[model samples]
Target: MENRIHLGDCIDVLHEIQENSVDLVYLDPPFFTGKRQASSNKDGSKKYTYEDRWHSNSDYYDFIEKRLTLCRKVMKDTASIFFHCDRNAVHIARYALDKVFGPEAFQSEIIWSYKRWSNAKKGLLQQHQNILFYSKTNSFKWNKTFVDYSATTNIDQILQRRKRDDRGKSAYLRDKEGNVVLEATKEGVPLGDVWDIPYLNPKAKERTGYPTQKPILLLERIIALTTDEGDIVLDPFCGSGTTPVAANMLNRKYIGIDKSIDAVHLTNDRLLSPIKSESNLLKKGVESFLKKDQWIEMHLTGLECNPVHRNSGADALLKEKVNGNGVFIKVQKQEEKLNDALNKLVKLINSREGFKGILIQTSNTDEFINNESKSIKIIKSISMQIREF
Candidate 1:
C-alpha cells in the first residue's frame, strides 16, 4: 500500500481502498462530547478545531458504526484495529466495534492512563482514556513487547521458571532432585493494557494546535505492538498525523485520512520532519525523577511545601507565595559552604522576577558573606541550630 493522506470523509476513503489490504487500522474518532474541541497553537496565533456535536445518542452511534464497518472491510484477516475513545463514548464505540468485528475477536480494552489535573469539576479527576483492540481473525498479528517490572514484582518470579501444580495453581519449578529450577533466560514483564504515559504538557514541541492530538510516543507503542517492518498502517481520523509519523518512524507505510484540509497540511509538514518531543519522565522512570533530598523533606514537613526535583538551584517551593511570587527554598549540601549556597539561591532569585528565596545553611563554614546585598535570606538548618546551641 502507498503511504499517503487522503482528504474527505474516512468512510468514503476506506470504501475506495481494496478489501483486506491493510495490515493495521487505528482510528481516534470524535467522542460525541456535545461541543466543538478547539485549541490554539503555542503562540495562540492559529487555531484548529473539530465539532463533536451530535443530534442524539443514536445518531452518534450510527455515525460511528458506519465508519467502523468501512474500516473493517479494508483490514486483512490477520489485521488488528484499535479504536481510541474516552468515557464519554467508549461504551457505544465498543458496541459498534463488536458488531463489525465479532465479539470473539475483541482482544483488549486498553486503558491509556495519564496524569491530568483539573479543578473545575467536583469529582475524581479525569486521567485516562480507552482504546478497544480488535482483530479481523483469530490469527491476528501481535508483537510481544516487554516493559520494566514494577518495584513490587518478586525477583524469583522474574528469574525462576514456573510450572502449574496438580491443582492448576502456579508454583516454582523444581528438578528431579527437588532443586529449584531457574529459567535459562528471561524477557522483562510483558507490556500490560494499562499504560502510564505522560500527557503532552503545554511546552511539548510536538504540539501542533490540534485538539486531542495524541503523543507520538503513545502511537509508537500501538504501532509496534500490531505491525512490523513494511507493514501497512491506517489512521482514519489522523488529526495531527501522529499515527502516520509513528508508522513512518517504525518503518511501516501509512495512509492517514482526515476531513480537515488544515489537518492534512499539518500532517504532511510533520511527515517531512517528524519532530517528536522526548519526554524525560518517560525516558527515566518516575522514581528517578522524584529523587530528592529526604532530609529536606523531613525539615519542611511542618510547613506547606512541595519538594522540587531536577533543578540546579531550588529544593522546594512553599505553598504560600510571598508578594505574588513563589517562595523558593534551597538546602545547603552537607559538603557545601555557606557562601556557595547563598550564591546559588541568589542566582535563582535574580533569574525569576517577583520571586523571593531563602537558603538553609546546614554546615558551618569559616568563610561568610554579608546577606545585605542579596535578596535571599539565610536561615540555619535545624541541625546547625542544635550544633550552635
Candidate 2:
C-alpha cells in the first residue's frame, strides 16, 4: 500500500506490493551486534529494545539475503537502494548485496563520518559507518548534487579554462596572444562518497531513543539524490520512521514496514509532525568555527581567554574577569586606525552594564592620542612595544 506503515515482517509485506512499483529503497537493518540493543527516552521514562542476535553467521546471512531478494523484486528497473550498516556487518552485508543485485549493479560505498568523545577500547575509535549504494540497473534515476569547494581550493582552478598541452599535461587554455582565458561561473564540486553529516546527539529533539535510529538528514540526502518529487520510497526496516518522515518532507510517497508495533507507532507519530535538527556546522561551514587567525593567536599568546567566532565587536573573552564580569579583548587590525578599533570595543562593553574591555593596540595610528574610556583599557601589543623601544 502507498504511504502506509505495515506492522509485520518485511518479506511478507513486500509480497503485497506490486512488482516494479517502488522507486527507492533505504534500509538500516541490524548490524549484527550480538546483544540486546536497548535505550530509553530523554527522561528515561520509556525504554526500547531490539533483537540483533542470530544463531550463527550462516543464519544471519540467510535472513539478510532473503529480504534483500524480496526488496529487489519490488524495485523498478530504474530504481536504487541504499543499505546502511557499520563495520561489524559491512563485509557480510556487501556480499549479500552483490549476490542479490549483481556485482555490476553495485555503486558507491558511502562512508558516513562523524565525531564522538569516548575512550577507545583497543585500537582506533569508531567514527564512521558505511552505506552500500546499488542501482537496479544502469538507467536508475539520479539527481546531481553539489557541495561548496574546500577552503584551500585555489582561485585559478575554478576560474581558468583548461586544455591538454602537446605533452598531454593539463594547462590553462590561452589565446593566440598567450593570455589566459576565463571560463563561465562554476558550480561547487560534486557530492562525494564521504559524507560528514553529524550523528544525532543525546539531547537532540529528533532523538526518539530507538537503539539504532538514524538522523533524518542522512535519509533526506539519499531520497533527494536518487528520486524526484512524488516518487515512491520504501523502508522495509523502518525503526524510528526517519525514512517515511524524510520522504514525506521531500514531497514523496512512502511505505514503511516494521515488525515492532512500538516502532510502527513511533513512525506514525513522527509522520504527523516531523522535526529536524538544524546543524550550525553545515550551515556556516566548518571553517567558521575557527575564529582565531595567526595574528589573533600570536597577540593573545599565553593569555587565558576563549576565542569568539561569528562576532564582530570582540575577538575573545578573558578567563580572568574584572568586577565579576567578562573582559572583552579586541586586537587592533594592521590596516585599522586605533580609534576605530577602540570604538568597536567600547560599543560592545557599554551594552553590558558591568563588563570591561581591553584594546590591544597593534597599529601605530593615534599612538599619542588619548583613546581610553572609563570602562575600556588600552595596552600596547608586545610587537608594538618592541618596535617603539
- What C-alpha lDDT values do all the predictions have? 0.87, 0.90
The 10-residue segment of model 2 with minimum total lDDT is 363-372
Q: What is the C-alpha lDDT profile of model 1 across 1-389, one tens digit per residue? A: 36899899998888888899999999998888899999988998889998899998889999999998888888899999999999999989889888888899999999999876566789889999999999999999989999887778897767888889999999989999998899887777899999988888777888888999999999999999989999999999999999999999999999999999989998999999988999888888776655535666756667788777546578888899887789888888757777777777778888999888888777777895778635588888787799999
| Model 1 pairs in collision | none
Which pairs of residues collide in model 2? Answer: none
Model 2, global lDDT: 0.90
Candidate 2, residues 257-320, lDDT tens digits: the string is 9999989999999999888998778877788645437778889999999986545678899999
Most TM-score-accurate candidate: 1
- In model 2, the Cα lDDT at residue 54 comes to 87
Q: What is the C-alpha RMSD of each candidate to the true structure, in Å?
A: 3.5, 7.3
Worst 10-residue lDDT window for candidate 1 reads 289-298
